[model samples]
Target: MDNEILLRLYSIYQKELYLYLYSLCGERQQAEDLLHETFLKALLALPGGHTNMRAWLYMVARNLFYNQRKKKSREILMGEQEYLSEKQTDKDLLEKILEEEKRRELYRAIRKLEQKKQEIILMQYFSGMSQKEIAAVLHITPENVRVLAYRAKKELKKNMEEFQKKSAGREDTK
Candidate 1:
């Protein structure tokens, strides 16, 4: 890829790729670092010509994240203390706390799913990847992606319902 086309691709996909990485790791700094590394590797590994650049970038980014994850599995952990140390007004802190709580609930629901379903839900919903794009990245058929997404949605709904019921029961006892 020429520098011009590569620049264009970077501009087009940077935000989405960064957001996807952030969703995966829930850390902005690590996501930014991975985004830069992803583009650098893409620049070096670009073929003579290619199709589905978005899927290709996502695949590369995903691999980079996982590779780094395995390498520093114990060293790298996102701690809540970091957030606590940040300076923030009471209103902003409250909003952040509420948002974090909601995110935790959603993540809990997703984690209750099977591994494949968790992946499908994260890629399709959190990363905003299309079924076709997910299929290309996952090396599965689009139909399979659709099926998995459907099943994942059902499973997430059931998990959320159960959680709500349990929460309600606790509230009643209280």
Candidate 2:
């Protein structure tokens, strides 16, 4: 692709792609960097005639994220237990998003999901990707994406109901 076409593609997909990366890494600056790197790599050797350009772009961005994560994993010097516990400290960041009540509750529920389920839910629902697109980006079959999405939605509903019941019980005591 020429510079003009590539820039157009960047403009079209950058926001969602940045969100995808942000959802993976949870750092705005890192996500921005990854988004830029994704397009830079695409500019270098993008294969021609892709049926789903969005999926291709996401795949590239996701691959870049994993690569950066892998390198950081190698560099971690703490013991396994300490390193794992350190990850839990990011929960403070979660508490800061309390301005939106329902969204906060939804995110709390989503946090309880397994990692892949969280990713599937974010990609399919939040990012507006179709099952086929998510499958392509994740390197899974579309059927698998559909099945996971079904299970995730069911789990989210259950969790949200539980939250509602708890909130109601709390109100009764007030």
Best by lDDT: 2
Question: Among all windows of ten consecutive residues in candidate 1, which has the lowest summed lDDT?
Answer: 74-83
Task: Tell me the deviation in Å of residue 112 in model 2.
Answer: 1.6
30: Cα error in model 1, Å: 1.5
For model 2, residues 1-174, the per-residue Cα lDDT tens digits are 799989999999999998888877877788899999999988997888888889999999988988998888843121111113344445654553333556767877888788778889989877999999999988889999999989999999999999999989999999
- Tens digits of per-residue lDDT, candidate 1, 45-102, equal 9665668899999989989988988898853333242255367888888888867766
Q: Which stretches of candidate 2 lie over 4 Å from their true place?
A: 74-99
Q: Report residue 41 deviation for candidate 1 (angstroms).
A: 1.1
How much does each candidate deviate from the true structure in C-alpha RMSD?
3.6, 8.3
C-alpha TM-scores of all predictions: 0.81, 0.80
